[model samples]
Target: MNPDEDIKGMFDCCFTIFYQLKGFGEEILEDKLVHKLIYLLPESWESKKIAIIEAKDLKKLKLDELIGSLLTYELMSKRLIREKGKKIKEQGIDINIIALKSSKKHQEDSSEEGSEDEEMVYLFKNFARFMKSEKERSKH
Candidate 1:
């Protein structure tokens, strides 16, 4: 949950602690563990956390799905930051006056490119559904 640390590392550290607890005879239910993971997420992840909470029933949710959504969000955000930085460099817009660099053509071009990455979308929706279906079939 440290803003300075990456989400992937933070989650991994939590899992390590969780395993240590298990080794020490402290049993944690999967649902509780998943809930705790979401609860401990930083403010920056509020939107994603809310989406997961509202979109799915926690009892049926797998830990991997939760992490996948979060990691996908993380990657998408990083990609956006990189793309925005590249755009700024291409435009030669002084960071000091970023507000003044608003141009209609620039806005239109950005809009046309779409706000969300298609690959990330596929990972969250299509891929997740496919995985869930496969898991259910395997259970039978």
Candidate 2:
């Protein structure tokens, strides 16, 4: 398969999995199965893929950085859930709560820090001021 096609295919699969799980209940999103599907998506898909995943904590995320962080969190959540499930299955007990706690922590850690827009805003303001100053000088 072509490199780009493969990435698109993987992203489509993840999208399908997310929609399918959504039918069962939002709780399925918290399940390890969904997380694994999300993890299967390529790192390059992180920006586009993040827009599809449902995250409660994403409210504070900046639009520009949200996509990448969301993808990273999705991948981490899936891995953590998979490992937790494997251990529980072997030990004959469910550690869903523990998995959730750890996944939340990882998500928080993976989320992008600071706002890029703030710097852009400062730069824009400076440029505008410079343009206004130039206009005044030209009038003189």
lDDT agreement with native, every candidate: 0.88, 0.60
Highest TM-score model number: 1
**Candidate 2 lDDT, tens digit per residue, 2-114?**
24554335556666877777877754423454355445556765654575565533334443353355546657766997997798899875555778877786768654422
**Candidate 1 local lDDT, 1-140, one digit each (tens):** 78888888999899999999999999999999989998999998889989999998988889999888888999999999999999989999888776655565567677554545665676789888999999999999
Highest lDDT against the true fold, candidate:
1
Error of 1 at 98 (Å): 1.9
For candidate 2, the lDDT comes to: 0.60
Worst 10 residues of 1 by lDDT: 111-120
Least accurate stretch of 10 residues (summed lDDT) in model 2? 55-64
